[model samples]
Target: MTRKLLLVLLFLMAVEMNAQKGESNFSLGFNYGFGSEFSNRNYMFTNQFYKVQLYYRLKETKHFQYQILVQPEINFAEHQLLNFYFVKPDTPNYQQKRDEFTRLKDIREYVLNCGFLVRKPIGKTCSFYVLGSIGPMITDTETERMSKGFAFADVLAVGFAASYDKFKFDIRPSVRHVSNAGLGSSNAGYNTKNIEFGISCQL
Candidate 1:
């Protein structure tokens, strides 16, 4: 009788360990948000952009976890003025200016970023975290005949995240500030402000 009881206990322990190993708590989600970008010479509001993320957490101690995020965004503006400058060798006002056609054009851009995220769990299903990342960005721009080349845009972003979870639904909000590394003119300076909301679930 004692031998039968011991065998039963061993079997139960093995089954529990296997169940934990097979548990699924990983998730992938999407983000939608709005923000604005400003340069030394130009400023504009960005339209809504899309974000994709992959996350993983431990079943026992959810405190330590990591995530990877990718984002492709768009910026919009109208009636933006482009300033022109000219330099003459012998004149007091070496820089001349031209006020030509004033029309609206949409600047197309693509961004690829990878972020490393760390989280600390709060209650039964809540956590606070922070992320740091850097990536490459490209912009399509139109220039006059005497122009040198197309403008380039560099991007870097860092921020914090807060997550609340109930059952299978999760709501995550993040705030970040991005620094634009000038890609075109020598004096080009760029910066942007951003706030994003993310939603995800486990399947």
Candidate 2:
């Protein structure tokens, strides 16, 4: 897991350097979640999800801009985000809260995804936007039964961004979905509601 995280970070740094030249803009963002009510469970703060991303601009107009990004995320505590099954309340595999906590204690997920963003500025320096992207994701797990280790993913997001000189800041709300794309029997998938906000600069 450490190696995976390290490699992702390195990749982000490389992208950062690449974005500094020509017409490209460099963006970095951090996001977290408040969970969701899904088929499996009522999510909570304990079902933590956080993401860090680096983006490079692709195109822009006075009110619209497009970009691409690579995101690295961590999902911890609530085991639901890491699993491939659609859990029901009365399932035979149900466990007490303590047991659930115990099982999730050691579980940590490291995920990487490539994505795209389409932003529209409301003002010269501030704007609202929508984003969508699909990519592949992998998780760290001892058992393949929980997940296939690799999956197809997608995200839908809306956000706002503002700039000051060469610096920029933004916030976003997003719904991220992931599925093994039928690679596993328990391919019900996972969905997370997230708020991603951050800063960027044009060079």
Candidate 3:
């Protein structure tokens, strides 16, 4: 199901590319993030993701530009349950479950993000932007906080970009949240703070 959804998005992007008269760009990015201490579970989480982004400018003015973004990424993560007491003493097989959930675990996630961007030019070669996106994700491992399989990832970010000739460099700091939106039994999502670096070219 995720593969089919990705294919459909790609097809739609291709069609939109051919139809649109505005500027477009393609970018590659690397992100590193660590979990924030806001959840009920006592766990430590960190992640790294490689991203591919497509941006299509919808409107441009002297001061601001609006664009649509489609991003697909491969994510690698590490999680460790810090406090065994989080499992509770009364649960069945509590000791075994605590041992299982406390061990350091590696996780993988595939994500597709669709979003919008608003940019304000600061100089001839520099701009600042705000972006918001939400998308479907697939997790390859289950842990105490969230179940394996389908979920949703949402992001909000602000960034700076510098342009030189045909190339652009970007640095963005973002907040991310992932959950199944109650589709699964476990819904204690992960929240993280992230920083990303990217380079792109007009296409």
Question: Best-fitting candidate, measured by lDDT?
Answer: 3
Across residues 1-203, which tens digit of lDDT does each residue of candidate 2 receive? 54576587667667767866654466666666545434443222234567766677878876678888777777663452344232444655544422352344334556676777787777678887788877766755422224547776687888877789877777777787767887865565666676655765553
Estimate, for each residue in 1-203, the C-alpha lDDT of model 1 and write its tens digit. Answer: 33464365446545555666664444556766655554534333344566554444433343566655444344442223343442224534334312331234454444555566666666656666666655554445432211223333343443334445423333343443432344443323234556667776542
| TM-score to true structure, per model | 0.55, 0.67, 0.84
Model 2 per-residue lDDT at 88? 44
Candidates in descending lDDT order: 3, 2, 1
Q: Which order, best to worst by TM-score?
A: 3, 2, 1
Worst 10 residues of 2 by lDDT: 37-46
Worst lDDT 10-window in candidate 3 = 25-34
What lDDT would candidate 1 get against the real structure? 0.46
As for TM-score, the candidate ahead, 1 or 2, is: 2
Q: lDDT per prediction? A: 0.46, 0.63, 0.82
What is candidate 3's lDDT per residue for 1-203, written digit by digit as tens?
A: 54676587567667766876875443333343434434545998888888777676788887899988878888889988888887788867889989998999999999998899999999799999999999999999988788899999999999999999878888888999999999886788899888888887765
Using TM-score, give the best candidate's number: 3
What TM-score does prediction 2 earn?
0.67
Q: Identify the runs in model 3 with alpha carbons over 4 angstroms from their true place.
A: 1-41, 90-92
